[model samples]
Target chain A: MGEPLLVQSPGVPGSPVVTVAPGWAFAAVAVLGALVVVAAMLDGALSARSAGGPAGGAARPFGEVARLMRQRRRTTVQADSLLWRIGGAGLLVAAALMVAVVPLGRWTIFDLDVGVMWFNAMDVMVWALVWLTGWGANSAYSLVGGYRFLAHGLGYELPLMFALVAPAIAAQSLNVGKVAAAQEGLWFAVWMPVAFLVYLLGVAAFSVWGPFAPALGSDVAGGVRAELSGVDRLVFEAGRYALLAAGAAFSVPMFLGGGAGPVLPDWAWVLLKTLAVLWLLVWLRRRLPAFRPDMFLEVGWLVLLPAVLVQDLLVAVLAVWRT
Target chain B: MDMSPGGIPLAEGGEDRDGLQLDVLKVRLGPVLPHWPAGLVLHCALQGDVVTEVRAEVLDAGDEGRDDADALARALDNLVSVLALAGWEGAAAQARRIRDAALETGDRPEDLEGLERLRRRVRRSWTLRWSLRGLRPLTEEEVRHHGLPPDAVGDTYDRLIRMMDRAATGTRQDDRPVFRVEHLALLVIGLDLAAARLVLASLDVHELQADHTQHEVAHG
Candidate 1:
């Protein structure tokens, strides 16, 4: 529902591209999003409440997390304590900023010339910082986690990079806005369905928000996060959510045609589409079985990588025919 | 020494002298580490835990003026260590009462509260030792024991067991619940063998007489 907020009869006349004021739009959306998150927390609390006690659900986690924060932070294992402090904080900051860069509705830091490249930069930053954290811990599980991250990153990355580029080839501009706009009348899904499928698959693997959730698994070297505790654990969990937010952000423009709706404003349409995709990610986590790392790597290399490459060819053919 | 039939003279030659029969000794317990508060002085009489005859003393730690009463209290309390041979209960009580009277005579709340609490605690130790003849010492053979040095404590053990007997089984000589070795050691250290043995018999430790002889044989 991409409806106009304040429609002007002939306001510079190209799809009536109305501008939202600087900071005002962001200030409003942040307030609304925070309220939504609060509501979601309350909803989650009510569902988890038990019959025996006062039903401290949200309150319990909040108090527990707060208490852990206050508790003396001591690393029992002999490791560089300084690195644990630094890298853990550094990854949290990186992930938070990456989340901020994505469009919540139509408001983002910028929909830059290389908006798609922005996500890749953020993705690379996360893994690097994560590796630092895992290694700094100087633990067996942490080392295994760092290695698994590298392995999984290598496996999922090729397909994801192709999927990101496939849409760019279809739109013929590196800009996410233009690519999203190209899918306006007929979503690129019609012509490049395999590429769309591959992109979704790639986001799941690379974003750390899917059944490709290798690092958080209880088994398999515990996926790099088995050794984290207290604030370290908190920062990691927050980073995961931030990355999940980024994944939802990427999916909007790729499959759903970023902010393309009839009634709502462009940013609102962007928000609606992004939230829908994020909810699906949550649903998949709830419903689907986890993917084995080797099996996923096989699919990524043998299957998805080839599919996006073919979609890139098809999009090129379609562009040539249109010209 | 008037050797009365019971071995201890009842009234020092039966002279109910038409005058105050007061005896006093001052005992200073410490250059006590900071954990053990300084200025803990006890003044007591030679009577018993019941304080049948009494007067007491203490010294001010930081007094530059050197008030006569404070000096006398210190002198008395200092003399209390030598009086330990006389008795801790008497010397402690005499030193405590003297400190109490001197501190109470002062208007300071800080000095009074701390000094008085120390006084009460020392008296409680005497009273506790009094009650503990059959109560079992923390030392000795781990059964019946005593508190303080043998030269320091008095014959409070016999009085304590007798009090317990009168209260519990209605006879001081009743040998039902016997005391143990710890209790005996405490009584020995408290320097009152007669009272200590009485407490032992009350624990029914008469049963261990054979074991005692065997131990004596091994040690001897």
Candidate 2:
């Protein structure tokens, strides 16, 4: 028989909160970073293959990193180097902070009361982080790319926040661990399809990878990150993939019943689910086209917002009925 | 809004539809843009990311090549850039692969088959059509007067379809290049930078290389 899960605090009975050694937190971050790198490598190969170029192969992403590292740093005249550096590094920091709350099996660094809100706040931070990187460059194209990201942010943020509400409401707690625990019997995703769909959209938007990638769109010549070169480009690229990986990992707890699976350790289940979600998000890029900001705004406000609200309403009613 | 040292209006102050004062900033796209046609520059006066005034010009006259193989290679290059802008990396890569194979091996059967499959997939993509449909619709007069290739005489979608068809067939039939340098400035004037890029890509504005040579010939 497995030992009873250790509770961090004694105040609440039957709470899903668990405590782990401090070393595990660092190990989790390292593992997540590796997963992100793998996802990015796969993404590069996928993009290359799709474009009819030679497949990036196993070593292409690694080779790209080396090439970028050796390239000399290029700077614009009158550019705010300080702000630009901050903006470049901020993405990785934001991703790390967001991922900190995500549970790996029964362990998380901080199982806070408002993990859902924390995740939302970190994503919103990405909006500012991208704009700052663009504006800091003082180049017209980069600045415009920054503006595009903000426009995209306006379209996706509210609906994304609304989608987050469904899981929190069903669990009757804002804590992510509790939400995952609530799904032990039946996953919320099975019932809350609309919210799940909107959440996926939100994931794409925050990561700026697939259809929602207007900020870094090629139309603006690489958008907000257009001016980046050398180490700056490398760090930013890593940060982007990390953010994407974190988004997919967070989805596991919120909708996919977290670590709950048959015949596998909780950590293994979390890893498997995270990989599945990450693969899905990356695959979608080739399947969909980037949406025009104006079109996306209209859809976000008119369609996605209303649809997620109704999903939230239904979840609320169902929660009450079950109670 | 500020004036430059040369007495040029660096940032023009303007009023929006809501009567709010807007700061117009001058931004340049390309001559150095990624996934953009090489040696093309766009000067834009933007009022809150909307292009209120725009100008297009060629910075460098490209290498002149008119052979059938070069033409196909150039067409594939254009296809690559356009697909990149559309964010269709898979199809764009396929085009590149076929183009490379055609040039290196002289239209191998396998490469042609791959190109055919790619054409079907791109043509069948509703997402591609949704992204491209009705954008930069051309009047029959404009298309004819420009001497555009017969297949390229419609919207961006039509041009893309034509490009795909030629790519699949590995055709050697010379389609008259229909690019007028002045039309670029005209077409991009009111469009936002993103739409402007799509229009330029669809037109394969690089085909204006021929027009540039003609201009140089007249001047020389």
Candidate 3:
């Protein structure tokens, strides 16, 4: 029962993952892009269904890309162009960097020891990137949108950090592969449900997806993306979907028993699990309302923080007893 | 010190709600913004996203009175705005569909059924309820003071449900007074931009007319 789910390939002797060559990073990015596309397509279809349109909404993403690509780049008065571009482009990079530590099945690129913390750091980088995107626009609405994200960050970040601690505590190792390995028969999500739920909320929060999307609310005229136009808007939006996809991918190892399944190969299971999670996140967008930053701050601090902390405590006690 | 960068005047400093001196930037919330009243423009003095001061105006408010035929559709359209602002896209889209159907086909039974389903769904949404609850509650006196309709008596959430009810029943009460553009500036003061937008959307100001007279809301 404790045997490794997938056979480790030849590379590092003691490591749970084989460090694939640098060229494989492109393949990883392609997978991330595919997940992003699928999520976008699904969201488009759902939107159309709700709006009483035919199933033709799946093609909306492609149409939008073409339209944006051909459109002119918009610039604001006194806009800090460099920082804006960086913030716009940095989300995809952060998502890429996060997946660097995530082991696919038996193979992983850049098998860092503290992979969980690496993923955490990348998410924290989102705080800066989104705000920078907001600030660089030099528009009043965009700036307000940026501040709203920071307010949400203050609420979600702590609880998210503690949620990460649960798996690390139960596994007694910060390494994500090791953590996945520790969950031989039991997934962390099944036992520490509070942490799992908070982690999902955190993922949604950091991705600026669904309920945590007041930063891009319609009232603020697209909020952070208020002034973004042309290819710049396209890239910024792609980055958001990519972040959501990456978050779902990372959760496989952290919570859902990574690469652990029957009949199908390990990599296939990982992809399937990721697709399921990504679909859930995208579907959730239609179901919930936006969380008001001020009201959410209280819920984050009062409810989510305490609940996840208790989950971590329970996991900690169980880990110690097992040892 | 008068300095204009990129032809825009620099923001002036003012005491914020926290008693800290902060830069107050003048920003306009649209006559053309999405989900906003069609011709209303709110010129505001913002200190860190909070509306410290405001002035309201409306553009192109012609002599033509309200279109009584489209009142139900307009009510549904306002519901769409409130739902969309609340971040419930599915429900917003559902409301939009019903609204569009109402506009196209008038009082179809299918549209009415859809509206009923949407009303129940929105009411059942604890998340939506939680998000909209207790935001900008206007008492009866406050409503009268603002010259707003009696329907605007409750908080944003209550107003939202009442808006749904208004759409469902198609009851345009004669006692319900017209909402002028000037009242917007007064109502939105002291709230942050998002909440202010929510409050405005909840009012379902279908009969709003342009009042060219500029009225300044006192800075607290």
DockQ of each: 0.00, 0.45, 0.79
lDDT of 3 by residue, A170-230 (tens): 9888877888888889999999999999999999999999999999988888889999999
Candidate 3's error at B77, in angstroms? 0.9
Regarding DockQ, does 1 or 2 come out ahead?
A: 2
In candidate 3, which residue pairs clash?
none
Judged by lDDT, which candidate is best?
A: 3
Tens-place lDDT per residue, model 2, B119-205, is 778888887788788888888787777655555678998888877666555565444563555557777776667777877888766
What TM-score would every model get versus the actual structure? Answer: 0.50, 0.89, 0.94
Please give the CA lDDT of all the candidate structures: 0.48, 0.79, 0.86
Candidate 1 residue B121 Cα shift, in angstroms, is 76
Ranking by lDDT: 3, 2, 1
lDDT of residue A86 for candidate 3: 92
Judged by TM-score relative to the true structure, which candidate is superior, 1 or 3? 3
The model with the greatest TM-score is 3
Candidate 2 lDDT, A192-293, residue by residue in tens? 989988988888887777777767877776778889999999999888888988988898899999999999998789889999989998888877767776
Pick by DockQ: which candidate is best?
3
Candidate numbers sorted by TM-score from highest down: 3, 2, 1
In angstroms, give how far residue A177 of model 3 lies from its true place. 0.8
lDDT of 1 by residue, A198-300 (tens): 6666556555554555455442234456566777766665555545655666777766777778988777777777677666654444223344343356666
The alpha-carbon lDDT assigned to residue A2 of candidate 2 equals 45
Q: Name the TM-score of candidate 1.
A: 0.50
